[model samples]
Target: MRKRERENPCGVCGHYHKYEEGEVCETCGHRMLATSEKASVHFSAFPSEILPQFLYLGSYDNASRSELLKTQGISRVLNTVPACQNLYKNSFTYHCLQDDKSLSFDDANQFLENCERDKARVLVHCMSGKSRSPAIVIAYLMKSKGWRLERSHQWVKERRPSIDLAEGTLVH
Candidate 1:
């Protein structure tokens, strides 16, 4: 319980209290701790900028927020998690791929390439933004920029700092 408290301190009151699932903060009567725990653990303090002025990579939670997407000038979303809801379907051009390891990258790469050609900013996201999405971005770098898999992966890692590409997903 102490470990849980340490990991999930209340954002509002700054209290280190263990909260039961759905429990409100006792000290300040805030629900910060409860809500914080439900957010995507894959999120980083800073998401990766895969391509300057064109592509961003982030988690499902980040992709669902229309205001954040608008603020970043993201005109399209390439969601790698098929089951995840498209919260801003009408507002942004969307492309969804099922989160499967065997999924092909040809279409996704084409979509991203189109975005680049049109000068549109696109956000690529999966459930966690750690695996599927980054892999897609890496493939794009390889195809469009003519980079090898290792160099593309390294470049993404340097920018995002928390990307974890799944095993066997690296394409040359």
Candidate 2:
């Protein structure tokens, strides 16, 4: 077996064990290791004022307030939470999603793309401005701007410091 496999868990021990080639586990004397460990990459938060001028990332509270939207000259909203009320339904174009982690974002992506084509200033928000909204915004950046998932995530994070992306949501 390769060195990578040997560094994994030995199945008996819950934690990974270090063993040389042809060497048994120090704790259990087992030669095998669990291959269930998945690799993940972490991104750092950067300090930059490079937010897109026409796009806004905010929370439900920000969406609920008419004055906030008006003050920012927001012309549309992409709401990613299920059953989220369109507070200014008549005033702005609204696109609502159910906010499930497994939800496909094709429609949301199309809506944001349309907004971009029309040069519409839009506010994208979910319940807490954390998982769902950020995921959608990241998707928009990927689809519309031709950005990779990691770069899109970093760009959104730079603008919205409070965004907490859901696990496995940052797909290219």
Candidate 3:
């Protein structure tokens, strides 16, 4: 620990900050709080199980929950965004998609399919469990279950009610 760290540590995430670091702690993406304030956690930190023990869908925060993932039997992860860091490479098998576009749907589905074949549980996630991650899960259903777009979507929606797809991401 550095001398500055010994002096002032972030109140919320407990990460030590240098004098130049200012208000927010870059380590945990949390802003420093005043003495009276308390830190809060995002509810979306836990992934929603989409398939009986085989698949889950959630946000980047969900992907970071290593111990929780292990408890849920998730041995692999399929990250839908390129920018989101893979928090536990050693703990879980991961395939980070380079981008999130319609063209990338096939690749995401292929990864999901492989995990299913191997009987491995995987968590598919983007920045939020809302749009990108759900889209990937929907695509996987279409290919694996012979379901049409609407049916596949409804299936995923039934499981995770929080999924809010952007208008442009939805097919007519």
Best by lDDT: 3
- Per-residue lDDT tens digits of candidate 1, residues 1-172? 5777888775423556644554654543334224565463444523457888899998765776778778888889997866666777789999988545555599899899899999999999875567878888888998999999999999998877667777776655
Most accurate candidate by TM-score: 3
Per-residue CA lDDT of model 3 for 5-86, tens digit only, reads: 8887654334576524445545543343344432332355578888898989987767877898898899999987775678
Better of 1 and 3 by TM-score: 3
lDDT of 3 at 120: 97
Select the stronger candidate by lDDT from 2 and 3.
3
Q: After superposition, how far is residue 147 of candidate 1 from its true place, in Å?
A: 0.4
Report the Cα lDDT for residue 116, model 2.
Answer: 78
Model 3 CA lDDT for position 54: 93
lDDT of 2 by residue, 52-73 (tens): 5577877665776777577667
Ranking by TM-score: 3, 1, 2
Off by over 4 Å in 3: 1-42, 100-103
What's the TM-score of each model vs. the native? 0.72, 0.65, 0.74
What order do you get sorting by lDDT, best first? 3, 1, 2
Q: After superposition, how far is residue 22 of candidate 2 from its true place, in Å?
A: 56
Model 2 poorest 10 in a row by lDDT: 38-47
